[model samples]
Target: MKDSFYKYFNCNNKEELYLKLKQNSIDTHKLGKYLKFNQEKENKKIVIRGQNKLFDYLKNNIPDRDEVQIIMFNSNMEVLSDNKFPINTQFKDILDKSYVETANHVILLSHENEYNKLLRLEMDFKLFGYKIIDRIELDKNLELDSKNGIGNCQFTEEDIINGKNKNFKEEKKKINSKELHEFMDYYAKNELLGLNIKDDRKKIKEILKIANQEKSQEYFGLITYNKDQNITNIETSLFKGGIREAKIDPIIITPFLLHQDTDGLIIFHNHPSGSISPSQGDIQVTETIEKMAMRFYKNVEDHFIIGKNKTFSFREEFLLSNYSYERSSNKELSISEKEINLKEPVKNKIKSKEITKEKSTRNRLRSRGQER
Candidate 1:
């Protein structure tokens, strides 16, 4: 029968066998799965030299006898079959025939020395329209060492022994918080010039500390926001020591805003003297950004001043209301406004906290009417 099988295919190598199977319309990978299912239902045993947890699991789970045929391979190229072939049968000698011609499933039990050879053999078996149920690795003593398979068929010795099937949904919920912290720490150290904190307020405070550590000078930061209100990107502009003022040019940042397709922006600069007050220059720059953003149908959401230990939000202080239609005008705005506008009560509360401190720095930046 084996001789007849060999003559039918007339193949010289594994690749030729694969092509032959393909031409014959045999879905080898699928056939492998089907054979595995049949083997499980029948509880067929294709034992190696020694027993282990994986063997025990298989013995307990599979049925006593079934129509499915299982083939086991060892380092010596020994073949355990219903019809006895020679004891030292070379794999190449059997390659001329298709595994599917003789068996329903192929279960390779490989020792450490035989693993690579068995892997190649398994690949050939798969190509020749054979369903491979298990490709298990055994130690030198032939005990259960590792279980390997592709896709859903993959399992571990522990999983089989404990009868534990994988739960993909629950597995996904396991967040690697350590990875997140590491990434943030690296970004704060290497990417930014200022301090890094997880909390927004603490982050601003740390930035203030770093900016004023040795000498006090203004540092400007631009935060770009997407339509979803998430801070998508951040950039900084540094000034010389003892320079209390910095200018922000919309033209310089226009390309970036357009590239990011930013829907809103927050422009912040630190006060080296720890003054939590927006200067006239700061207000003027905010208005300028607001005007330019309106032209592109974008928003100047907030302008923040990071001071000694405190931070001031131009939006929270109602200084930005005039540039936002949803805040200043009573009429209904678009869905985009719904995303950018703060609630009326929140605006009122912010307006109640009157601006108590201010600084004088002049720049002729005017505001255009807020676009709906």
Candidate 2:
């Protein structure tokens, strides 16, 4: 049976036995459990036998850290320590008084003949709520093996020494307006938006594309900037269309901007059916947002209304001059004639009213002729 078993497993020697056990998904922790069960069944101790390759592997990988606590158990199942406990001390006594609770990792080193003792100690530590992170068994010549008793306790040499893999590198990609334009064009076709801009110009271009999409409704795109005008975060929202109105509260975004230490913000919204002109509501909302931002020491960089392949900039067309003129002289708010005429909705409404009045006059004349 033994010959058949060894032949079937292709394990010729103790080294091969250890390798087969490791390769068969029987890790050190599971092996420890199996050994404990056998010991209890036979009412006798079972020792772990292995080669020194496992120990050498562990020594090469395990980082030397002050936070790691090493405990050595002798063949007699006694704890041996020069710093904390004396030689031939009882394992339970030393363990009960040890400072293993404060350690990040606990390494157990013992002889191959002491496997049963080591397994019992591991079980005890687990029952006592202490994690035995690493365990190694030594051969007859007191040499360490390459196999670790606990499977998940191993760490890579690079991870331990340098905190991360030395060969891993992250590519830093640059954002440009051309890339943004392409991305916007693609997403607009899908009736969706992707807010992943890391550049200011990229963010502005994306918002413009979203606003100018042919079948799109009103969408609000907010771009937050740092003190150096670098884009920090971008967000967007969809709103009901046809009414040509959307409501946004500056307070909803103020907390996040404050947390990010934002220095400025740029807002853009679409007017699906009208010209790229700022109405009275647009001006009022911009002023309200500006006031709120000022209270938090933030700046409103620009508010843009995108319409039918064109865009209106409030700062360039109105706010900058309005603020300067207001500071110079206190006066009622006034809008330029060009701005009013540029508003397509206002012109359409006026034309509709004139047509209605002309129809009413013609109908009254026809009614008088019929009565005569």
Candidate 3:
């Protein structure tokens, strides 16, 4: 089964990128537990796998960096990914984010010489146990000068043909801005938000038909609407996939949400097989983006799967449910600080943790360069 989590972020060679991530570290430290894969596969290093915090960070920073910049592993430890950030991206901007999956086996690419920034960066990644590969150290590993290593990763004809980067461009017909705008305005002016599911389902299906009409490959679409639900702002066909799979990504969709007026979304994709039924993979990504929307306090109105003759809606099917993440906040406590009673923001930094029936054990940890 295809998964957007495992989709390519770029065309970099996995083996070369992994060597850059693994063999090139001047110093190395480890963290977290070994776990079972969601399912087994041959050892491979994906360029980058998407995550909630990565999506959250990309919402604000991808423009400045042009792409993600951390090489880390998903919790399963099966896939190692390299994401390089810009020199100016500050550590404070992404400190202790809401992680849907744990990030470890990491190498943070940085070249900063600022003392406080370096110290803070070290302590922060140290807590998470991520490796920091600086300019000199990275240049030494790549067998090239600094910043030139990215181009060194080799690619083959097959890699480029099937790669995500190429597919995003070559999969769809190139329509000029005017042509795209006219197509968008037709639906926007028709009040797409007010359609009645009982009577207007056919009209909705007609729209999907036009959106993916005559395309032999699958592609993903994200439609953004104004806060009042009256106007359609942007309808972006983000990624094109093979005959069956398309990358349903959050970061690519985040820029639209950055517009203050855009509030609601409907994520749709066409199955070239002419079956509108949602696959397990489809269900997985719908839940993924839905949870992401909740983080922005936005709603994913529906997930639609379009086929030659039918359309399926996740909302109408009751396949998705409410997801709530308690926001970390500073507020006055009901009781004053007396004995065990805590006051505003009782912050706790967990040093170590374990779980067992008998008693929880704490692992020995190095605290600030000394073993404790």
Give every collision pair in model 1: 32-131, 42-63, 43-62, 43-63, 274-308
How would you encode candidate 1's per-residue C-alpha lDDT over 1-372 as one tens digit per residue? 112221223544334544554455343333223223332422344544333533543432321111111354444323334221232345556644324233445565543555566577678778766666676554433244445432122334553333332222223224343332222223333333322222354444343333332224666767665655555666655332345777665678677557645666667777777676665566667777777767666677667776644567776666664444332342334434543464344444433443322111111122222331
Query: What TM-score, over all chains together, does every model reach?
Result: 0.34, 0.34, 0.35
Model 3, span 1-372: residue lDDT tens: 232210132213333323432443321111000001101111223433333333333222211112224445555543344333444456654543312255655534332243344455556766866644322111222221222232232223342223213222221234233333233334332435555434565555555554453456787877775555533553535778999798766787777656666565777888889777666677778778867766666667677887754567766655553432222341212212242232111212111111231142222233433652
- Per-residue CA lDDT of model 2 for 67-128, tens digit only, reads 22244333432333212233234667756656432433345654455566656666766776
Clashing pairs in 3: 69-83, 69-84, 69-85, 70-83
Question: After superposing candidate 1, which stretches have Cα over 4 Å from the reference?
Answer: 1-215, 238-242, 323-372
Better TM-score candidate (1, 3): 3
Point out the higher-scoring one by lDDT: 1 or 2: 2
- In candidate 1, position 325 carries an lDDT of 35
RMSD of 3: 22.6
